[model samples]
Target: MTATDDKTVVREYFNATGFDRWQRIYGDGEVNKVQLDIRKGHQQTVDTLMGWLEADGNLAGLSCCDAGCGVGSLTIPLAQAGAQVYASDISAKMVEEARQRAEVALEGKNLPTFEVKDLEELAGRYHTVICLDVLIHYPQDKVQGMISHLGSLAESRLIMSFAPKTLFYSALKKVGEFFPGPSKTTRAYLHREADIVKALEAEGWRIERRTLTKTQFYFSRMLEAVKDQ
Candidate 1:
């Protein structure tokens, strides 16, 4: 599919029940293997980001933008971590859900501003910008551009996660695509770590840390990159 077609599929997939179901998995505290594995991987990535953010300096006054802030998972925590957060998502439904969750999580105080925006459309720079798990929806060619855009938005740091490319993992994903299940998703793209780093470097960023999480059903490479002044 073309980039536009992939974007449409991603928009529709997250707008439907599939999105809600994933939210439930993220919220339900992992009742099944898929949920359990995904939760394990997702939490690890979030923790890695948070750790890097804190290590960078005080979080209380820094501005953070969470691109593809799914259901307020990272957005809520980032706000709670004492950062001013601006959260956006390509899916309208996701932005709405994230706004609602942030309201509830913050006890009716909306600390993190929420909006429906895509990576390509996100504007403004912050001390740090994070785009997690969202890269799986982008093809290889597009991933680099998105990474560059994200890099440009961060004055100091950019944290992101992607399904890492490896022959074995790619083969597994391809084989699994043949059989559809309840949580079946739109086409996912796996990217090489080197390619992502090169994209970041092109935008004047350097990786400070890297973390990988792998489970029976989940996998991701989390990188914390700091921009060069």
Candidate 2:
């Protein structure tokens, strides 16, 4: 399929029931069960990301974008930390749920604006732009274009996460495909670290740090990169 076609399928799939079901499941305190063995290091991952943001110190008054900001998991925290965040998702239901969660999570505090949008429609540059766990929806060949678009949307830094590629990881992904309870979308792509780095390099992005979170179901790798001006 062409990149446009793949994006359309991804957009449709996320809008259907996948995103809402995931939000319902994870938002209801089932993250531990759904994630199984990886629960122990969840806070560490968040802490590490927060540490990265804090290191720059420029995050205090920066405008940020959380692309594919599912259920406000990362969006709420960024807003609470004082970033002017704009969060968006392909799923309208997911956006609504995220808005509700932000209302409760932020309470009287300033919260990020949430909207229904896909990565392709995202515009403008941000001090920091985050797209986590969203790359799986794109095919491998199109990841470079997507990464380029994401990199262009960031003025200084771009943070992203993807399912790591390895022989064992591929096996696990295949297993998930077979035993899926919900997410049954075809053509989800798992990415290799080297390939991802190459994609970033093509768009003049320099990787500053990367974190690998290992789990039974999947392995997630988070990266922080700076655009070469």
Candidate 3:
């Protein structure tokens, strides 16, 4: 698909289902298997991110940019932890919902900067740049550019996650598409780990840590890379 098509598909898909994901996260609704699987996967990602952020030290005084921060999963929590956060997503509705959620979730804190923006539109450097579960939207050919762009926005650490490319994982995602109802699926890309590493390395970032988070029906390869001084 062309870039425009990819954007349209992703925006539409998230616009429709992003709230469902949010509600499921808060135990607000009954979720189907696909939604439940995604929720489970994201929970792992958020927990992992929090641990990494704690290890990075001094959360109350750090700068963070959470690109593709769907419904404030990571954004609100980061802001609550006392970091100044700039958060963005491709879906306008998602951004709005995130703002609303943050207003309620972070009542006493300075709200995170939330905007509807594509990956390329995000600007500025931060102590840490975290983009989780969003790389699955980009195909292989575009992954490096995304990685490089995100890496450039990080002064210290960059954390990202992608649906991993493996014989079983690739086939699993494909089979998932077939099993989900027509309205329940969107374009999903599985990326090679080697290529992601190469992209970060070229940008003068080295992987500090990596892990594979596997839930019942979801798989994500999460990496934390630090810009080499």
Model 1: how far residue 205 lies from native, Å: 1.1
Per-residue lDDT of model 1, residues 1-229, tens digit only: 8999888888888899768777776775537666666777788788777877777679987899999998888899888878999999888988888888888888865479888877899999898898899888898899778887888788888888999999978888888832235666688788999999998888888888898988777889998888667
Better of 2 and 3 by TM-score: 3
lDDT (Cα) of model 3:
0.82
Backbone atom clashes (below 3 Å) for every candidate: 0, 0, 0
Q: In order, what lDDT does every prediction score?
A: 0.83, 0.78, 0.82
Cα deviation at 100, candidate 2, in Å, is 1.0
Sliding window of 10 residues with minimal summed lDDT for model 3: 177-186
**Each prediction's TM-score versus the true structure:** 0.93, 0.87, 0.92
- Residue 55 lDDT (model 2): 84
Model 1 pairs in collision: none
| Model number with the top TM-score | 1
Tens digits of per-residue lDDT for model 2 on 124-184?
8788898887888787877888898988889888888887788977886677731245665
